[model samples]
Target: MNASKFGAEYALSDDMAEFPAGHTGAFEVPYPRSCCCSSGDADLLEAARTMREALQEVWLVMDALGAYQSDDDRLSILHSPKFSSAAYRVRTAMIKTQRVAI
Candidate 1:
């Protein structure tokens, strides 16, 4: 499943459809337009990308936990390569989003 599916409700909300062409629908947060040098679409895209990465980490962590067969297995899954990779993706995306020409 796509990571963004986790936030489908918010991402596909009616509020999104209400945004004007250039208005950064950064949702109700009122994140200043000056926060990014890029256009509204760019800001929204970057935010969506970051959200996807973060959700990926969440899913991976949950899956890892569910796959654990025993107490020892829990630690192994938590430190598993897949979980680590997903977490790294989230970390990088978060950093990228923060530095998105703000």
Candidate 2:
């Protein structure tokens, strides 16, 4: 894995003070392989691990955003039921993939 690809970009701002210095922007997520014909159990495990890791990054962002108090309605959208449901679906997928790998 390219560790640098998972790093968040930093920008200085007053609102940013609540967040960690280096954890402000989006990180790169791995693109799904177009073909998995040659993939083996190890590959599946690695893919599942990658998904879990990527989701963790998302959760970190969500947590940070949730901790932030803003009057912006757009920001509130992130905490909506629909968004929670979507995140739950992804968590379910990760769990299923991990189970299959095990």
Estimate TM-scores for all models: 0.48, 0.31
Model 1 accuracy (lDDT, Cα) = 0.70
Q: Top model by lDDT, which number?
A: 1
Per candidate, the number of residue pairs that clash is 0, 0
Angstrom error of the Cα, residue 80, model 1: value is 1.3
Over 36-92, each residue of candidate 2 has an lDDT whose tens digit, in order, gives: 644566667666666776577567556656645575754666777756765775776
lDDT of 1 by residue, 12-65 (tens): 557667877676465566567765545656876877778797787778677767
Clashing pairs in 1: none
- Best-fitting candidate, measured by TM-score? 1
